[model samples]
Target: MNSMDVVRVLARYRFSYTNEISLQDQIEAVFKYNQIPYKREHRLSDSDIVDFYIDGVAIEIKIKGHPVAVYQQCVRYGSHDSVKEVLLVSAKNFALPDVIGSKPAYVYFLSAL
Candidate 1:
């Protein structure tokens, strides 16, 4: 499948359970399915604590609500050269507030970024 198709397939995996599966876990599963080489967080610096670190890319996933603290954490953790990219994965209707600056980023809905 193409990249878009792959993203769509990944989007469908999002579902709410009593015990919710984390966004990093879901993204890791997708990466595994696609045979994408990745390494989870193996370091514990102040700026290294996040959901997942795939191929040195720091990804912070959020659900529907806009948590200011979480967004700030992602920005701070992602502000390093070791981090290739900082991505915010969210549900279809997730709205971010204006406090966060316009940085290099991507948003994925039920479709590709």
Candidate 2:
């Protein structure tokens, strides 16, 4: 599906959660609706985990204005040897540097990239 379709799905999920849904859940719901296969990382003590992994690509979903720590954590995960790519899907527009068109580990905005 196109990027706008992805954004629409995320917006729907955002509206469904009145009490603040986890970022991972929001991302997973979008992938689920699109039938994109993915696996969720599990952790007992962590408040955040890489939202989804699909075909070795780790995607971290965040709403606009999420803390800097969240972005850093996603960057860390994306830098791992096991991760082929890392994508940051944001709810609002933001600037991102070019990644040489790499398959994974590059950040992307939901509506723009």
Candidate 3:
């Protein structure tokens, strides 16, 4: 699926996460429910490991932490050759640029869903 398709699929999910791990589990369920193919803990490099991967999109799940750190992490993920975009799933809302390293970046806020 494309970036927007991924976002729409995730937006339909009703998140009930208590932590990062739970959020990941909920995301996995959403993918399964939608019959979307994905990989968990996909390693982009020695230092970059994404929470999930679908097609050319790298998915990251974050329940807490600094937004800059998350953005930096997504930027690193976007640099990978296999990734065409980055999808950030967070429990809270934060500003993230639409593009990072020429790859599109999209965010799905759990609270907004």
Candidate 4:
């Protein structure tokens, strides 16, 4: 599925815990329940790792952080050859732009639903 499709699927996911690890686990469960193919904790390089990678989308989960740092990280992930888009699942709404670099960027806040 595309990044937006993946986001829609994840948007329906319900979470009882808000911790980063728990959120990751719930996300993995959602992907499995929907039969979505993905790689958890995908390593892009020695220092750069994404929370989940599906098709050409790289998803990152953050419970708390400076918005700028998170966006930069997602942009770095987008720079990777395998990633065509970036998705951030964050606890707080960062109001990120529609695109980061040449690839599309999306964010879903856990606090919303």
Cα lDDT listed for each candidate: 0.54, 0.54, 0.85, 0.86
lDDT of 4 by residue, 23-85 (tens): 899889999999999999999989889999999889999988897898788888988888888
* Model 3: lDDT of residue 111: 88
- Local error of candidate 3 at residue 90 (angstroms): 0.8
State model 3's lDDT.
Answer: 0.85
Clashing pairs in 4: none
What is the C-alpha lDDT profile of model 1 across 1-113, one tens digit per residue?
Answer: 22234346566665442221455566777779877666665353764665656655555556554566666666675566666555556654444442233334444553322
* Candidate that scores best on TM-score: 3
Error of 3 at 110 (Å): 0.9
lDDT against true structure, model 2: 0.54
Model 2 worst lDDT window (10 residues): 12-21
Tell me the alpha-carbon RMSD of every candidate: 5.3, 5.7, 1.5, 1.4
* Per-residue alpha-carbon lDDT of candidate 2 for residues 85-104, written as tens digits (9 for 90 to 100): 55667655544433413433
Pairwise TM-score winner, candidates 1 and 4: 4
Question: For model 2, which pairs clash?
Answer: 85-104, 85-105, 86-105
Q: Over the stretch 1-113, how does candidate 3's per-residue lDDT look in tens digits?
A: 87789888876667776788977888898788878999999989899999999998998988888988888898899899999999887787866799999988988877833
Candidate 3, clashing residue pairs?
none
Ranking by lDDT: 4, 3, 1, 2
